[model samples]
Target: MATDTTTFKHVSYLWDEAKAAELAGDEVALLIYRSNLLGADLRLTNYGGGNTSCKATAKDPLTGEDTEVMWVKGSGGDLGTLKRSGLAALYVDKLRSLKNVYRGLEHEDEMVELFNHCIYDLNSKAPSIDTPLHGFLPFKHIDHLHPDAAIAIAAAKDGKKITEELFGGTIGWVPWQKPGFELGLMLKQCLDENPGIRGIMLGSHGLFTWGDTAYESYLNTLEVIEKCAEYIEQNLGKKGPVFGGEKIQSLPKEERLSKAASLAPVLRGFCSSNVKMIGHFTDDDRVLQYINSNDLERLAPLGTSCPDHFLRTKISPLVLNLGTDENLDDVAAVKEKIAPLFADYRKMYEEYYSTCKHPNSPAIRDANPVIIIYPGVGMFAFAKDKQTARVAAEFYTNAINVMRGAEAISEYTSLPRQEAFNIEYWLLEEAKLQRMPKPKPLSGRIALITGSGGGIGKAIAKKFAAEGACVIINDINQERIEATTEEFQEAFGKDSTAAVTLNVTDAPSIEAALANTALAFGGVDIIVNNAGISISKSITEHSIEEWDRLYDILVKGQFMVSKEAVKIMRKQDIGGDIINIVSKNSIVAGPNNAGYGSAKAAQAHLSRLLSAELGGDKIRVNTVNPDAVISDSNIWAGGWAEGRAKAYGITVAELPAYYAKRTLMNEIILPDDIANACFVFVSGLLNKSTGNILNVDGGVAQAFVR
Candidate 1:
């Protein structure tokens, strides 16, 4: 039969002929292709919430023996961007052996240990809880996805019969089973029953397909899910509009705004924005009619579409009735009523735990619904933020559709309560929860300081080291290299930071410095392009040699360092932060320093461009423009003191006050003041703020009274 094209457009699929041809090929490329295919399948399923895996050969650590191992995707990874390390390698033989054990094993703790055992490299990321299932799959490529259309159809009454007819005999149907060992066993049975079946569709769960190659398995999954989607759309018709609660005309204006704000925060927390609050009321006339209808209880399940969704949206929405006053003051009363219902839900959950769990099963998780739907007020999906709330909503909506359809097909049957408990409380899943390394704010993270060993650069390095960032100190001063290294070691502690005596003007030296810094710190996370030499020559007097020298370090150096940093950051997948230290001269344009100002201006603009390009990766790039801060150490060495003294027709001693008085704040800008700006940019406090230049000249650049 020709496949309907409606769902096919929405579904991502590989042509059957192409997949079949690719599968009839060499194994290694096929393995990689399968991995990508599984990634693509997951991305299509639930819009990238799930992952997939496969078994491959790698050298065993203990025996140094070549062993077959199951490499599964790591936790907290998006399937679309999964890499080699994203997959954790587990001993395939060991996993298979564990599955065949006769004696009852301590499933949770031992399974957790087994998951940990797979993490042979401490530096490597942790594997997911579903790793065991991937290991159990006899096929080299396994695909798992929570397709919305298939689940919607499977959730209705007579779901089994409908699925049977839709997929025909080639597809095996397993009643909704909680994921993990029990589901694994059930699937294994289904596999045994239909040896030639292309895939398995779980009622009220999801779809699973496998193949000798990744392409076949992935294509099989797409074809099957597409068919199910087509059947649902053709038969079930479009889902009706979601009902919003009754309008609250009687609510106090202030209270209503507050209620909106409260809801806004919840949504913003999930979605990362405090925008609109879209609420659906269960108390709406249509909803109330549906609820009061004899079929209400029949439609309402205790919780969400799937157990894992509970982590996002709560078990069930709160059903509100219009009989009660819709006042913010009465919100407490609403919650009070919800308390008992939740209590009842918990009681049911405990009973399920008692029936389903083994005597040795681990503790049960707290039963709190991620979403609460009010009858008249509307629905609230609770989560850490709006993004999470939206994700929960999508998951629950898909689940509700599936459950509704499954109820239509057959009595809505989910995985047994005990099986759900096992999957929910599975040790393997828990083992995936590893603590993320705390951000250094500065330390160990690679930093490239442009004018290192000089005044501001030295001070910035010292401050960064004090805050914990490893320093890559660059300087044009070959004479001061040894002394600067000593000073850095003294301030940052031995081995805490390093010094590189390289002219930032030289591209080769800049590249080499970056390589050394990466080798020293494992990766580059921060770049401080602070090195710049100022010349007090007017445009007419500015020599080509002087202009080249100034631009080479001030502008070209910043470009080279930023370019190299981005390359490293992209590879590491840890977004980097770049701080370009420009000068107030770049902003205010001091006479006779046109070349210096022009270069710094270019550098400043470069920061903005980089910020735009790298923001998607979470890399922040910003510039710091500081007014003159005079120090005897800086002035005496670079001829700045004499030159400025000549310009002002004053002694070197008067130069400090002359510069300090220029600021409206009348406060002397110190190198530390500039370093302070660097600190804030690198810290996550300004995580969302990037591109713009931060004027650290004591409000001098504001063009206003201080």
Candidate 2:
């Protein structure tokens, strides 16, 4: 469908050189920048709508030589802040070869094969359905936008003529075509016809442009859309009649009217216009005359501004004319009329499909409209969910505006129906549906672990990496950090983990660590605050330095990491899980742990407070209080267990068994146990269980029996 030119002019691009540098190289930075440009343009038309891609050369595994690869934006990724991992890389040659095979394969089966052939870059996520289009383009950089200004014009009568006049011969125009295979073919044809054209404008669809470089492609897109917006603004005002003055259509019941009223806010939210009910009879003659016009049929094929938007809005809105003497307030009557109309629409879709399909190439798709825009009444953009609905409404609103303006010139035109169908049902477009190994339950998921070089921290880091998460292992000891990273690389492939030597007490170190983590893993999805220092001196004898060190590592470190992790998590829309490793001293104080006990106690309270405050964003913060666990690092070298045993006058040999016997299992607990507990805390099973402490110390500390 046509996009709104006005909306295109207001589109903004998001770019950050620092973020680009963090991504590792200029090539990735360029990709992110171009993706953001496309994202901004699509957002102007439909929130979270559209996809973009880049084709580059990568070393092939089989030949060990450079081969073409398509780097496409992943599904469900927000383009505004997309990172390198947000893109999925697939072999471009493989996808291009599929175009030559015209066996009329089932879309779903072919999709599976395409996905099977798809290869994920070490960092990127799964590619979007539009990956094939990127492969189809000859240029290195490609941009696809569902621009409101363009869709608006494409959706109106004489849309093609308007596009030709406004954009002229420099821009190739393709008729309305479904977005996958058909659109690809139409685009190919346009390229063949106008080899020198800068871009192709899809009538009743969107726009496609490419360049040799990311910047060039992005700038070209901006320039073209800006021109389109200027043309629309100069020719036609982007305003519609206010719905407030429309006569209210009388329904059989008040409830029916109420339902319509309820929908008004939603419509107004998108259209930014007041809603009023125009009774079928107040201006019966005018309403009927308008409905009876042949233009109604002509507008039917305008379809959706883009095909993916179909998931949000239905195909089209029903044309309704209220009858005189009908009950003006009956909700049931309204439902009755609407329900039957959907059935009729379904039947009509089937008939259309049957008429259009060729014996050798015919295939059927679900009979659902992307959106329905009522002529007199405000439009109802329906999607499978609210998110989709919002996206559809945005695209529809812009498309309508463009259509209205284009009608000023000539009858808007679109690609043939069959062409649109091919694009909508192209095998390449369905590739994303293929099943792959479920991301290691944590793939694309990030975890920041403190004290990750030793004991529980190391265990947790390795465990998370084994489970498919990219781990950011943090510790104060440089040696431990490097050693732990080495151990993790040995256990889980080297590419799965990163190590950062960060002193928890240092703010700059913490910030740098977080920045590095974001660059390495895109963003953190989980934080395990396991770093802490313990002192055994009595409160009166303990030095201020010792106390401060304890608090800094246990309390301040957790705070700093949590704060930064939460910021990234919130922006990424995946609420993170923060598990603080507190001691049983926080729940049960003892005689000689003034410094350690106080710090642990503060950490526990901090966890509780963060849980309460961040719960609104769905972030789960909790404490894991373990009584005591014997580890090589913690027992032999002035570790907590060794110090406590010395204070109790116990032998090192007896200390391990003594603590084990104190627990119900009488089994010595390893660091892996604590790591496993942390894993459980971050998993979905504990998604709703936060703000409380989980005691994983066997039976040393009983719940509610301190």
Candidate 3:
């Protein structure tokens, strides 16, 4: 199960001997210990996919007597790293007694209601769907999982025969049945008939193992699954390609990253209608091997090895191969090709539902594909944000491995289209979406913060991410960007931030960074032009190179970044926000500050010009003039602070107060003050306001916008 080929890898068997010894006989502790062991394995059960349970004893508050209780994994709890609180305790007598009161439970929902109401402790959580299956089994410990290898055998047409041969009668087989009270009864009947059997394979579903102790049950699962894995390797190793498809080698890493970076945003725009999604790209060797295979198209559409995956991956991927190596640069052409494919994909999904849907199935959900595979380039997965997109992408990556394993063992077979439809439209998955908290104002959007390695740029990046925008940390400093991006990811969550090295003065460098920004989080929807430098010198004293270098970065550099963003924003048709970081020097001239002041002043007016030009295209352009915002700012790092302090005839420590006292409000402006002004523009609080200068220099009268 820990093989390189297996997506579900068990890193190590770790257990706390002290804790185990402390509660050696306590069923709750044993269940917690064994559940953690199983849940920690991604290959054993994906995040919260499977459940575990055990029978325990608890004191009845009213009766003052030790009562039998069943501890099961609570609803919405993941098995990996599950805590004792994550398990719910139910009175075993009360749970088993329900069987007599309500025989032949027909509906899945009602069974859930019964389980929820039967909790022995008022403080305990609700029970999982499989609570009864564990409660009914007379064993002390029970474990169940949707292991990919086990499911590959269990979901097969001749799964029972295969299970019989693989386990040699050590495990029992139960036919497919909806998981409810009936399945619980069926399993009870199965174990009753075969008293010596160590486990049971639920055909077309998963595996269940039991023992008198937690260790016995856990070991049974590992041993049984390992046998099944060996069987597949021996049998499927020599098999020919079951699904015939043309072999296509993917572009190398460099080519694929470039190509994928360009197309991901376009695909995001294509898939999105109401809310834009972020895109994540991957060309892992395994993923590339699968995508580059001759049987990708023929194999990918067969459905998931297990129905549970359908909830996340859908019935089939939205293949965007173009089936060629041609460039997909034209926005209109890319849309034209995708529109028809999506239309046909939706139609086929609808037809699949119509032809295969069960009568009790839920309504058809969104038809957009969760995973998009583009041949010759790589794969793109889209979601409301980067974390969700990457989750689905990783799942698909692991799934591709699982599918390939199946294909090699035999023809890659999958659950029927109908089963996929059933699981996807199930209420549990729907509830996950419905129960989600309301998104922040800028959720699902992306903002690129230029020069975010330190100072005001970093502050702006932080504020934007705090407001729910996935931030792209662009800087010339590789080390700083890496550290800052990690901090953002830890504070915000995976896919919350990205990092790219950018030299604004270099056209090729800027283009590559912008493409990378698109690859990381769809496209940059908010561009913060914050990177700049200051050189205090008189116009006459400023050498030609010094003047040109200052202007090239402050004025020309911003234009390059803005121009690239405008193109992407225009193509997405999703209106964008741009805030150019200028200085109060732009409003009022400063002595011997000609090089810095003139560059900022020119860029400030350029903002006004772009505002007029891009307004019709739904791109807002604005500028902020700050007199002093030196908190962690690198702009003053080039000996400019000491020179400016000398000009004021004061120490560098007193310069902040000097600038603050000069302003009308006498308020010391911090990096956060500048960031706030930018957020106002980005959040669209003033939609009718653009081409305006907002000063963050503590109310500077001389720098007033009027």
Where is model 2 more than 4 Å wrong at Cα? 1-9, 13-24, 41-48, 57-68, 74-83, 92-129, 152-168, 174-196, 237-302, 320-377, 414-706
lDDT of 2 by residue, 566-668 (tens): 7655544446799999877887767778888888889999999999999987899988877666774352455556567766679767887777887887777
Q: What is the TM-score of each candidate against the true structure?
A: 0.51, 0.47, 0.90
Q: Which regions of candidate 3 are displaced past 4 Å?
A: 1-40, 101-106, 121-125, 242-246, 350-364, 408-413, 540-543, 684-690
Q: After superposition, how far is residue 410 of candidate 2 from its true place, in Å?
A: 2.8
Q: What tens digits encode model 3's per-residue C-alpha lDDT throughout 332-421?
A: 877777788888877888888788766766677667777888876778888887877876776676577567555655445676665566
Q: Rank the candidates by lDDT, best first.
A: 3, 2, 1
lDDT of residue 396 for candidate 1: 61
Q: Candidate 1: lDDT of 428?
A: 50
lDDT top scorer: 3
Return whichever of 1 and 2 wins on TM-score.
1
Residue pairs in candidate 3 whose N, alpha carbon or C atoms collide under 3 angstroms: 8-43, 39-79, 39-80, 236-409, 245-294
